[model samples]
Target: MIVHKKPEPTKVPGFWEIPSISFPIHIAKNFAKHVNILPDVEYWSPFLNSKTCNYLRDIFLESMILAPVSINGLMDQSYGIGSKRATGWSLQLSDMLSEFIIPHLNEKFCSAKTSTDWWQENPKKNQAWLPVQVSPLFRFMKYESGGEHYAHYDAGFMYEDGIHRTLKSFVIYLTTNQSGATRFIRNHLEDIDVWDRDHSDWNRRALKEEVLYSFLPQEGSILIFDHRICHDVDVYLGEENLPRIIIRGDIIYQAKSL
Candidate 1:
């Protein structure tokens, strides 16, 4: 699928708390061939005004927006666009990853530019409230049918307005298959309600400690969710001998440090 016009915004569930987001993913052949060779996965693109990055970030801070994401590498060179991670249907987050991910954040929010500049965004009375610095961590996993992930959730804030943190998540879909779709275990905002409260029941029983959730990925489908919800990605079991690929990114900023 080829995208020409800017997409229309859809009011999704509470994925917006960390602020979740989702968009109609588009994919086609050969998208992988050219983008796959991108060296320095962290390469910075200086064209700030370019729509490429603007549209990607536009998914969130709608008005005059920007975003930052840490992405994974591409699948085997032989795989096409919807079959690889980097080349999948994802917004170019490297613009934020390299240019704004770290440096811009430091300059914009906290005063921690250098390691020595580790100024506290918020000081906890005790280490118990040390305030976790949650970040946007992303991954690209390939699997089919039974290879899909079950329902799960992430660790959430233990305090209300106290020590809150937004574990925002976004996924980029590359291929379109009737079989590959994202499903939510419970209501969406449940994650947002507990965003600042210590909750882990939404996570998987096996990796309870990791707070990792499963995603049924497609080539260029992007899904963003509240970091604190119970959700899962359904597998893509198309019989046409096609592989699933996705390019994922994490856009994390300090919890209201600015």
Candidate 2:
């Protein structure tokens, strides 16, 4: 007898789900003082091209220097230096990014609520606080040998019926080195023998159906896509042996209440 399994849904990018991982490359370059290029296409193009929007260099540098704080060090990155302490610069940058990107990202992405929604979440109950704002201060996660990330999906919305989802989650790779690469390590098919497809779970099973896209986000380059897709960073042991670093930030859009 033979059996069949359902085909997986195509992991397409969702524009309405999560925050679109894009930078205001165009607005920053042109600096259309008061013109509000917020809705212009010419606005986003220049941001991706280096020579055009180079002012952002200072921002990335500032973020990189400060990301050590929010970074969980060993826990989040799975490996790091002496101690696991968040620095002042880290906190400041997180706050600054949250404030600066609010209006801009809100304008670009299709989120349900704005900054105000953050205050309503009632932190005392959740314990988990969302970034009211985030900036490009995130850096590369370094790990020594035997470093690995357990799997978990970014939380999605759920109704009484257990129906929920987020629009998208975009990751901006400031740079990549060492052993970092988006990898999908699941059995393509079910088993028949030792040579058959013996499915193995690498990082646990928080993320079932997902796609990991390895991106090379230049100084201003960004990787924009869906958030519901389960993802994780691979601990790298690069031959160069340099500390892997990348600066990134995050934001979330909620559904408007009825």
The most accurate candidate by lDDT is 1
**RMSD in angstroms, all models?**
17.2, 15.6
Q: What range of 10 consecutive residues in model 1 has the weakest lDDT sum?
A: 64-73
lDDT by residue (11-129, candidate 2, tens digit) is 21110111232443332353222223211111121133453223333343333432222112222333333111112123344444445344544323322221112222332322122
What TM-score, over all chains together, does every model reach?
Answer: 0.38, 0.38
* Per-model lDDT: 0.33, 0.32
Residue runs of model 2 more than 4 Å from their true location after superposition = 1-132, 135-140, 143-151, 156-170, 183-212, 216-220, 224-227
Model 2, residue 234: C-alpha shift (Å): 3.2
Task: Give the TM-score (vs. native) of candidate 1.
Answer: 0.38
Model 2 collision count: 16
Tell me how many residue pairs clash in candidate 1: 27
